[model samples]
Target: MGIVDSKGHLYLKEDPEVWIKNNPASRLALVTSFRLNLENGVEEIAESIGELTHLIHLVFRWCRSLKRVPNAITRLHKLEHLLFHSCSRLEELPANIGNLVSLTHLQLSHCEDIKFLPNSIVNLSKLTSLTLCHCVSLVELPANIGQLASLTHLKLSSCRNIKSLLMSVANLPNLTSLSLSSLSLSEIPYNLGDLKKSLTRLDLSYCNNIEFLPNNIANLSNLTSLSLICCNSLIELPSNLGQLKSLSYLELYYCNKIKSLPDSIKDLCSLDTLIINCCDSLTHLPINLNVLHLKLLNFCPRFLPNGLINLKYLRVNICSCSDESFVNWKDPYSLQHLAISSCFSHCNYILKVPASLNQFVNLQVLSLHYKKRFVELPANLVGLAHLCLLDIQHSSISCLPWSITKLRRLRHLMLPKDFRLETLSYELNISVIISVNERHVRKTWEELKTEIGQLPIPFGGEITNDAAQNPSIMSHPGYLWLKENPSQWIINNRNLLKLVRFLDLEYVELTDSIMQFSELTHLCLDIAADICLPDNYFVTFTRLTHLSLHFFSVGKHKSITHSLSKLSNLQTLHLHMHHSVLLANFNMPVSLKYLSLSYCNNMRPLYDSLEKLTNLKTLDLYSCV
Candidate 1:
């Protein structure tokens, strides 16, 4: 009954009964869903699809060679979902596709050659979601697009040729979410305010030509989130924007022409988060801007205004202008996360953080990004006892405050790449992680234990050996086991360590206990000095395919090199020693398929040793000075 390959041809003589195997009595009854995966040489599906009388869903995703959808598909009276995702060669849909009155979802993402949609598409009364993302050649939508009365979400992002939308779109009564990112739209219909009753989210990011929002946009009382990122031509927001009572999030990044915000913004009582970045012309903010109980806010302006009394998360980038107004720490204490970035491009200066920072008794995370500023942190940090994460980078500070050792609740300490502090109080046994990027960081085993503690386990919220039966136990990068001070929960569940596949260690000594992790495949080590590994260190690491070594000295060169040679299954190796005098020679396993030696300044090309790695497919030697 299953047709595997047709080679762009259809055989109508095949019995329809083969497609349905459950019953001989219903041989002619078409199934509710028909999913076809065309073979390598199959380029087309013939018009026989019309014979599927009961078909409600037809999905042909990953059919890269398909050039067109058969017009006969319109014959399906019950078809509700038709997806052609990644049909790269598809040029167009049938002009009369709207005949499928029952269709509710249609996705044609990544159809590179599609240029237009049939105007009749607006006739699909029940259509709820329409996605045409990354359709490079799509120039526009039908002028009567608002006729899709039931449409709730319409995504036309990455359709670069779309210059404008028809004003009729404003008439859709049920549209809730619309994304027009990465388009050439110059302006949206002023009547978009008509959707105020139902529209909740609107994204117009990367619409570079948009100059201004319609003043009538304030009528969207139900709107919650709005994004206008990278709209370079945007100059200002509607004066009555504060009238949107339900608005929770408003993001406007890189809109350089905006100069000021309306003082009426204080009327937005429900506003919880607002982000405005890279608006070079912006000099000031509303006088009473902080009246709302905002949970998260990211703003960059010359002079910051005062009343932020209830912020839980805040990121402030100070422009060239000096910091004048001091922050107001809410009395009932709600602030938890705070980050400050200096935007002084012309010169390096020391920024003085107000001592009032200690007022946030409930503060948890504090991050600082200084281009060239030496910020004098608060002398007394014991008041911020709840703080857990402290991140500092690209700053010129002489040393960390001695009070840092007193923060017992602190779990993660991220320092700059060139950070020089070598010792820390062993009593403050938190994990010292090196920030790698936004998504991933270098974490130590002790930090890894904290990560495991955060997981939601079933038995008393502890990760027990029997807890492994629950599939969600080891679902995330942070939900892994490591050798830290063995808690009673871990002591009762020694087998739980076998579930860990990734291990990141900082300044940890190599020991024989590591070989017990039979499933560990990824390992990262940050060594400050020498490490002598056991003779058969990697013999049991048969599954370890990725190894990263960030060393500061060549003291363990022979020991480390000998240990690496035993990793016979290792296919990827990353060396991140930046100092010049480190080991210039390496004896790597021939099984390595990817090798990266970044920031090894004095490393010279070893042609002979490299030639021995015949299986290597990628070699990155970035910044080898």
Candidate 2:
């Protein structure tokens, strides 16, 4: 029989007439799966479920008030999966849960009152996965947990009081993934090295109390990814870490105690991405480092690696550096992206763009954001033939660089907020200038579009009048002319208004005329923090599937919500506001599948309104206070 609502009254009656009247025998022989999710008032389940002997899957997700499950459920012999995710009031599981010999997966994530798992669970030799994330009261695991030979994935992330794992945990021969993040875990069991061949990923993020990793961790030959974020007490990595041949990605963020990377890291042949952020004491990188393709070295600008000539992306915040060292820097051979910023204390000092910038022939993007310190661009930018994006904000430069006007391939440009021109000495031949003050940028963008769009037809290349009259050829000019115009030409084409499927407007005035573009599937608007959405502004885009809004103020929360409620087709919504904007209550579209909130520091504890969004599959929050 299929499961009904969690309420006791909704369960099948004792009489066979209520469920499968023709063959009542099917209840015990044929019923295979039961689900009763999102029911709020259920406190306990009826004991009559003991008759379901063939049930394979049981789910009770988000039944917030459920205090306990009936112990008689242990009678099922064929049950393979049992889940009670987000059952906040559940205190514990029945001790005889191990009676289900066929059970393979068990999950109890977000069960706030669950304190421990019964030792009887160790008897389920076939169990392959177990998860107890966000179980605030769970303190320890059974001593014989390693005896489950078939167990492969184990997660105990955000378990408040768990400090260490059992020493025998490493004995699980088939284990592949282990996650123990956001906990007070100070030490890993010494025998952890025993899972050398099976384990592949290990996460130890937000474990502030962890002082160091086990030295024998290098024995894990199959390990590929390791993360150690916000582990403030960690002083160093194991010297033999290079022994792991399969390792690819390594991240160390805010590990204040770490002084330098071990030189042995040079041996990691597969390493591709390395990020070392806010490591205060780090002053140098490993000498022969060459495995990384992308490296972000922030707050430690004094150290520059020598063999990184092949790097594709590099971002650095140099806090302490001399004029000589800054100017003598060499450009990477194929560097495509380079971003330079200074620490707050050094923001006001004059920092010249290195003359060596002209050597980066392959550079495609360059950004600088030192308001007071930045003074000029290299006099000769023509050498950077591949340059396409240039972002210069809060700089002290008095005028647009003369060489910049000659860049034929440049597509996008972002100028400082305070910039305004009273005279035009050189023509801006580029397609777009994305800036907060759109009045000036938009006007310039339109003028450039018209000038290019109205280019006279070449005398020899002119098409016949008969070809121009053909419906097929006249309907699609882009197919034949796309290569002739500038790279950004199509985006600003006058006849492309209806063809535009995506639009991003930042710091621009909101007018009713914007609603004319009914073909938009994705739209992003970033208004000023103090501005509010215009009334009746959102109903026009009935076809938008993805939308993003940024920089909201406190009073605009209600208006934002009202506008969002009209977008019934939106599948993804993102809101980014300053720390002071608080959102207490709002109505979200039932169609939304993904939602993200960033920098919303004052948002109250989100509860009821979120629970109503039953279709949401992912929710992300970043840097919220």
Can you give the TM-score per candidate against the true fold? 0.61, 0.61
Model 2 lDDT tens row, 1-625: 3343333112331222235344466434656776666466767776766676667887777788888888878998888999988889999899999888999999988999988889899888889999889999888898888888899999888998988788888999999988888889888776788899899989888988888899899999999888888889998999998888888888888888999888889888778777777777777888656554555455644456677665777776655463333343454667788777766556667776665667678889988767767755765788777888888765654335547656767777666643322111234564655442222343454443332122122223323224432211111111111112222333344344454444555476565556666666666676776556676477788877777777657576466666776789877776776664555656678887777677776556445578778888767676677
Across 100-165, the per-residue lDDT of candidate 1 in tens digits comes to: 989999998898989889988988999999998899998888878988999999888899888888
Find the candidate with the highest lDDT and give its number. Answer: 2
Q: Candidate 1: deviation at residue 437, Å?
A: 11
Off by over 4 Å in 1: 1-44, 52-56, 61-67, 86-89, 290-302, 318-333, 341-356, 368-379, 391-400, 405-422, 426-625
Backbone clash pairs for candidate 1 read: 1-18
TM-score of 1: 0.61
* Overall lDDT per candidate, in order of appearance: 0.67, 0.68
Candidate 1 lDDT trough over 10 residues, lowest sum? 451-460
How far out, in Å, is residue 452 in model 1? 22
lDDT of 2: 0.68
